[model samples]
Target: MSHFDIFIGEVTGTALLILLGGGVVAGVVLKRSKAHNAGWVAISLGWGFAVMVGAYLSSGVSGAHLNPAVTLGLAIEGGTKWSDVPLYIGSQMLGAMIGALLVWVVYMGQFKAHLTDPEILAAQPEKEGLVDQKAAPAAGPVLGVFSTGPEVRNALQNALTEIVATFVLVISILTQGLNNEGDGLGPLGVLITAFLVVGIGLSLGGPTGYAINPARDLGPRIVHALLPLPNKGGSDWGYAWIPVVAPLIGGALAGGYYNWVFA
Candidate 1:
């Protein structure tokens, strides 16, 4: 693919990815939305489907490496050009921002309703014990609908969780060729990877929200900080680096392990 194809493919695919993924968050988090209180299972499945759709949409062109971690892993494995890394990552970020912006547009009503009605906090629907991020103490300083936060306030544990989960994810991508299909993970690999995301979320998302992808968290967090939603609090800029840096390190480490043992 030419630079244009790579850029366009990733941008469009990633945009759709975040559009639906963030859309799910808004659906469940916003006070007025029907999907409010749909719970974590819904979130995990929604994100998985988002990845599947995004990857399938761009597979022929950019191979749909929508996550910067995936791009980095492939690049380290000699599949993608190092020169193209920045462009791929930049497009993904831009696409994510666009998608998150669209979510705000789609759910503008719910946002106003949630923010304007301070009583919604007391009216929170029951969860089966899952943390309600929008509630007191747990909500911290920011709304999680636009980004991620830890249920527990430990930075090291949060970063480590991201690192370990992302390490599994990138390693899975690197070895997806060895699956039933054959080498290169075909169209089926997108599905597999999407399921992998769900598995990571279901098993490992309790601490942090399992931000296995850098652009996924960062772009929407930026949008949250810039958007003019009523009473929206801090962006939690202090902990932003963990989601971005840990994923890169984890991806690189996975790629190195793949080269050493699996190559």
Candidate 2:
């Protein structure tokens, strides 16, 4: 495939993917939204549907590798040329960032409300009848909108969880073929991937929110840091490396494993 086609296809596909994916998170997390408090199942389904729609639209052109992990895994598996891998990742990152930005625009009022809501803001340690000015800030609501965090702050466990989930995701992508198209996953494969993402979210997301794709987490996270939102706390940069590095490692591992087992 031509570089231009690949870039545009990936960009469009991933933009749609994250737009809907992040949109669901924003919808449920933000207080002013109708979907508020819809909980995890809705989010999982929404993201799964996001994958389905995005893959269906882009599979013909760029194989719907909306994730950097997927691109790397495919490269390692020889499904994608190594030379095009960078373009795929760059486009996916750009797309994810753009999608996150759009989510902000669509939910601008909700974001502002969620961040500035008196109920949430007053729950901070400083407002909890504590006179200490050094009280810790509350980052949960806003952070949930942008990226993931570990439930227990255990790095080793978090990394292992992401590694295992992404290993399954990337490996499945490597082997799941529906249409026999070169490198491109067919319609059935897209549907299966959507359900697979949901399954991963339900089964493996509890520990670390199942950030199987680096671009999916990091791109929006970068946007969260850059955006001008009220009371938006730290992007939690300390824990950010886990999602990115672990997924890449997992993808590489999956690729190597698949090559060893099936190649």
Candidate 3:
């Protein structure tokens, strides 16, 4: 694919990925929505469908690497060129931010109602375990709709969770999802990958919400920090690096392992 095609494809695909993925969380969590409290099954399947839709839309154009971790793995696995890595990651981040912004737009009324509700505002800090106030609350009510956070505060465990989950995801893609040319996923691969995502979310998402994609987490978190949502607590900068760094480490290790053992 040409550079322009790669850029447009990644941006559009990643945007759709986050749009539907985050939209599900918003629909389930935000007040005044029909799907509010629809539960985890809906979330997991929504994200799975989100990945499938995004991948199918962009695979023919740029191999539909909607995640930076996948792009990094593809590059290391010799499917994607090193020179193109920056474009892939940058487009993914931009697309993620755009998708998050769209979610806020779509759920504007619900967000306003949820955040402005007197009971929610009063109970927020306590729910986030910030009453003692050692640092900023790591999460807020709607933050999960945009980004991820751990249910527990153990850094080592959280990092390991993200690393292992991401490792599984990248390795699965490397092993079974790549096309013949190694540039991207084929039709079957995309279907398998989408279900793989749902499985990961169902099996391993509890601890840290399974942020196997750096762009998926960070770009939306950046938007969360910037947006003027009432009572939206800190962006959890303290925990942000783990999701970003650990996934890259996992992706790189998957690539190296594929080269060493599977090649």
Candidate 4:
């Protein structure tokens, strides 16, 4: 595929990813939503299916790695070209941002409605009653729209969970690619991998919100900050570094370990 084709694929794939993934978050966290209270199972399956579809759409040209962790891992494994790494990673991040922007727009009406309702805001005691809390106000109309807070210890645990989850993801991708002689992985494999990701998030992600993809977490977090929403605060910039830094470290370790074991 040409460079332009790869760019387009990455953009579309990332948009779909954030659309489904972020959409599910909105559904669950947002109050008065149809899918609210759907539970972790719903989120896991939603993200898993989203990944499967995104992979099917972009895998033909760009290998559909929507996550930077995957891209970094593939580069380390020597499956992807080093020269192309920058473009791929940049495209993936841009795509994610764009996708998140779309979700923000799509849900804007809901946000506005929630903001207009005094009762809705009052219902969230944590944000409503706090006088000078350290954390920022919620991003969207609903409480905890884009804000994720964990205790100090839980934060570390969540970070560790992401590392292990990413490790499994990278190792699985490498193993599957090596075993398959076909031109590309089939849809079933994509679906199964998606399931695994969701399972990781549902089972292990409770602590830190399962930020398996650095770009996935940070990109949307940026959107939450920039987009016009009532009571929007500092975007949780303090903890933002953890997701970006940890995922890369985890992915690198996984890739290096996989290469060492396989070689």
Once fitted onto the true fold, the runs of candidate 3 whose alpha carbons sit more than 4 angstroms away are 130-138, 177-183
For TM-score, candidate 1 versus 4, the one ahead is 1
Runs in model 4 deviating more than 4 A are 123-155, 178-184
Model 1 segments more than 4 A misplaced: 121-142, 178-185
* The best candidate in terms of TM-score: 3
Question: Which model is ahead, 2 or 3, in terms of TM-score?
Answer: 3
**Candidate 4 lDDT, tens digit per residue, 87-149?**
877888888888788877877776676666677666555653442344434323442344344
lDDT of 3 by residue, 87-146 (tens): 999999999999999999999999999999988888886675643355446576788999
* Count of residue pairs whose backbone atoms collide, per candidate: 0, 0, 0, 0
User: What TM-score does each of the candidates earn?
Assistant: 0.90, 0.93, 0.96, 0.87
Local error of candidate 1 at 180, Å?
19
- Model 4 steric clash pairs: none
Tens digit per residue, CA lDDT, model 2, 1-263: 68887888889998899899999998998889999999999999999999998899889888899998888888888888888889999999998899889999999999888888888887754542343222223334577776887776778999999999999998998888522234488788889999999999999999888889999999999999999998887677778899999999999999899889988
Which ten residues in a row are the worst by lDDT in model 2?
A: 128-137
